[model samples]
Target: MMKIEGTLYPWRFRLVLALLALMVAAIAIRIVDLHVFDHDFLQGQGDARSVRHISIHAHRGLITDRNGEPLAVSTPVTTLWGNPKELQGARAQWAALAKALNQDPKVLTERLEQQAGREFTYLARGLTPEEGQAVLDLKIPGVYGLEEFRRFYPAGEVTAHVIGFTDIDDRGREGVELAFDEWLAGVPGRRQVLKDRRGRLIKDVQVVQNAKAGKALALSIDLRLQYLAHRELRNAITEFGAKAGSLVLLDVKTGEILAMVNQPTYNPNNKRNLEPAAMRNRALIDVFEPGSTMKPLSMSAALETGRWKPEDRVEVAPGTLRIGRYTIRDVSRTEGGVLDLTGILIKSSNVGMSKVAFDIGGESIYSMMQRLGIGQDTGLGFPGERVGNLPNHREWHKAETATLSYGYGLSTTAVQLAHAYATLANDGRSVPLVMTRQDNVPEGAQVISEKVAKTIQGMLQQVVEAPGGVFRAKVPGYHVAGKSGTARKTSVGSKGYKEKSYRSLFAGFGPSSNPRIAMAVVIDEPTNGAYYGGLVSAPVFGKVMAGALRLMNVAPDNLPPPEETKAAVAGESSKPGKGDRT
Candidate 1:
């Protein structure tokens, strides 16, 4: 049998034949897999070598004011990205890219070196169309520009604080941008394309997802009102030589913020040189001891508690009252002995209000303030809103209660004070202060009886109409009621008030017959010979309110006679708080 097999085939030949058959079978199997069974896998492997990934950016949403005016928007832009691993003449390429990107070559070289093995590195963000094209013309390998968007603030500094700004990645960084980031940011998209050896796209492999642009947002602000407020605020700041200033106009019925302005505001378009003080939205963020502006709250508390009436009398001995070891005195040193509740408000007597607060007791007074929305957020949705410092009743010292009565011990933001006044103007029902419109009017929680509110309103009106009171804020044809607040700024190391620095505030609501607008204006450290709220801040309030009322188309209740309307002489005392005198 061995002899017969040897004769039939040579050993080497048999071995070669066996190896050839095995090789042929392996080839057939591989062909089948590549052609049919596992074609998708093999195709993916081929694409892996030749395909390039590119990102498609989705457009960011638009920001419009209440009247559909564009405050901020997204405009087409380009971003340059590169594959450092594929870059040739790394130094020259980097230098060219840096020149185009307006960046330092040395910094770019370092970035490229760090990302040597990386497939992608951002060379520059938010390039203009011309700049993007210049880079594209360089024809550098591994470098490409993608279409994107950059935020544009059309109203510039006027709408800066309200609209805010975005980061490089089109994400909100501050203000409304930060508050509504999710709604403002849109979904991104991606594409895979086959590229030739030269990195030119040859074919599309797949489209993973389609990009969706962000939805548009409408705000409650009016651009015209915003501009008016800004211009007036700047002029006031400059004229008074004040340290800073803020003004806010509110819709009395709905509580929608019509205009909010803070001086030392920054241009959102050029934020590189912005100062911290300029960026602060003082309306909602800064808190101060409200001084006599808070007396109305104290008096209302006293009246609501049935311990006192608008006609109740208090003895203002020496124009001062001593509580615990502390003594409270009126701003005016001319002493008066007996005063009614209305007289206390009209005179803005700290001595009288302290007695009233004592009559109301600490708990009821604090509870009333809490219900009036003081020491709380106004639900305005603004960033960094401070629920201004209000000490617990249990923690209150006798001095704290007495001083707080006349707005000394506690601190509050301008917005909170405005909201409190708005509550009073709204007939003792507290509506949620809003920045956006709602379909259904929010039901207000009753803070005081309508009777108490009416009495307080009448007394406050007297504060404006009375000759001795500080409210020379009356416009010729309209009824106005408000209080002037003057508080010596608290110093860090000083035991008492700062020598020359004081916070002056004027807060009021208009057209007493039918209140429509509620506003607050504050001037910090006015240096041009006047420091009282009535002297420095109220006139600005009058001008702004006059403009706002005209814009609102409210019929004038009391137009001045032609003689009264004549421009006052340069040095005449036109009115107590008129700008001419200030």
Candidate 2:
């Protein structure tokens, strides 16, 4: 019986040993297949969980004035983002995360819940490097930080209208920014990185694509002139208690925009409560009836027809002319009766201008305005620029034509008016207005002959020199030539004009004999007692031009008399210069 039991135990041991060998062999084969045959597939799945391809933001271009003064720039910043799924059940760090982000715990929780299905969501944007580092140091799972850029304007509201602003995503929205977005925006690249379970970047694997920086943009603006214009325009707005204003200064020879500014401007850096009105580049986008400012153009047209002369008389007797039901009169009822073309301009008579425009005929006047860049774009490459309305010759009734001549029926922008004045300064050669610096200024279209332009310019000079001219536009030792306009504001959503609400405007240039700069200033809704262009807008032009001429070292064109010079040197009282009105 013992021998039989021993034999059975040996058989059982052999069967168990065979089973153990088979199990070992099967386990070894499985390990080999996973490590060698399916290695790529398993590694891919692991990488899919731990690795990511992230955007490597390209640095936006630098915007600078002609003198290399920085305007719009891109500064380094960090953006914190996270994957809600990775952050799921990360309740322990939620409070700390909320604290670091300056967010309420409940809000953070709700946001996470809302974004639960999203792979990426921004927790904070445009954070300082130190702040982002502190958040990353919290070691919260699913939290991450990416290096990015934020647009910054060093000049702030001073250059708001010209330089414009970008969105949080670093995209241009208006002004030069929107006009040259493609040129100013850079192309982004990509990078592969290893991230931990908490979504923290563990290692930078490789650059998927090299990022290229946007090309730097150099504008034609002179920072010195821009600052001067801004200060003067702001002062004018404040002094006049105006609702808003716009000013533009151009280089006569180059047709380059030397300075442009808008009032009620917003700071691009902090635009959480920005208004649409404040963001508009008024000089280029907003159009207003140029009022008496358009008188010079009318005079130019009449002169071009060979039917009118500087000495030609227009009997504005009673200082008013009836065109149908509308009566055109001078501000002073009897101030401009029986005046020549020169006198008409000097006195800024609506009656005289209406008659003159009527005599010239609407077709001729429209053609002249078109040639001078009125009712047309200045080609400054500005966004949302409106081509001013010019009624077709066939469409003009006698009254409509008269009103258009005096700048009531038609409209023009500050830039367009400036460009037209610049054309006069350029001896009637209509040049293209440009915002960016150009290597060579193109040949301008000949609108009026040099003789006509010179004659008109001289006549305009009398507008500042004559007794009834714009005396407030005077600049010491400079023969300034300009026109002032005080037009009733057209009521919005209605056809009639607003009573007592005026749009004051001034368009002119300095050194009347040898013009170097052409400028236009417009003040909207001056609530102060003085609302005339000569009283409100011309002073801004004077102040800005005085500084601009001195800064540019423009030679004094109108030297004072010996007595006056001596008196000025001695700080003594002296009589005004010739053509100066008391």
The TM-scores of all predictions, comma-separated, are 0.87, 0.88
- Give stretches of model 1 more than 4 Å off: 1-34, 90-117, 196-200, 204-208, 333-336, 395-397, 493-497, 560-582
C-alpha lDDT of residue 509 in model 1:
87
CA lDDT, candidate 2, residue 78: 88
What TM-score does candidate 2 reach?
0.88
lDDT of 1 by residue, 337-359 (tens): 78888888877888888877776
Candidate 2 lDDT over 1-582, as tens digits, reads 356754768988788889999999999998898799978878889999998888889988899999899999899998999989888868789999999999999999999998988878999999989999999999887888889999889999899889888888988888788889999889999899998865667899999998889999999999989989988888888988999999999998889999999998999888989898998888888888888898899889899889988998888888767766777778755443588899888888888888888777877778888888888867666788888787775666778778778787788899999999999988999888888887897797887999899999999899998887788899998999999999899889998989899999999998887899999999999998999999899888888888999998999988878998787866644445744676
The best candidate by lDDT is: 2
Q: Which residue window of length 10 is worst by lDDT in model 1?
A: 567-576
Model 2 residue 13 CA deviation in Å: 38
The lDDT, on a scale of 0 to 1, for candidate 1 is: 0.82
**What is each predicted model's overall lDDT from 0 to 1?**
0.82, 0.88
Task: For model 2, name the residue pairs that clash.
Answer: 141-198, 142-198
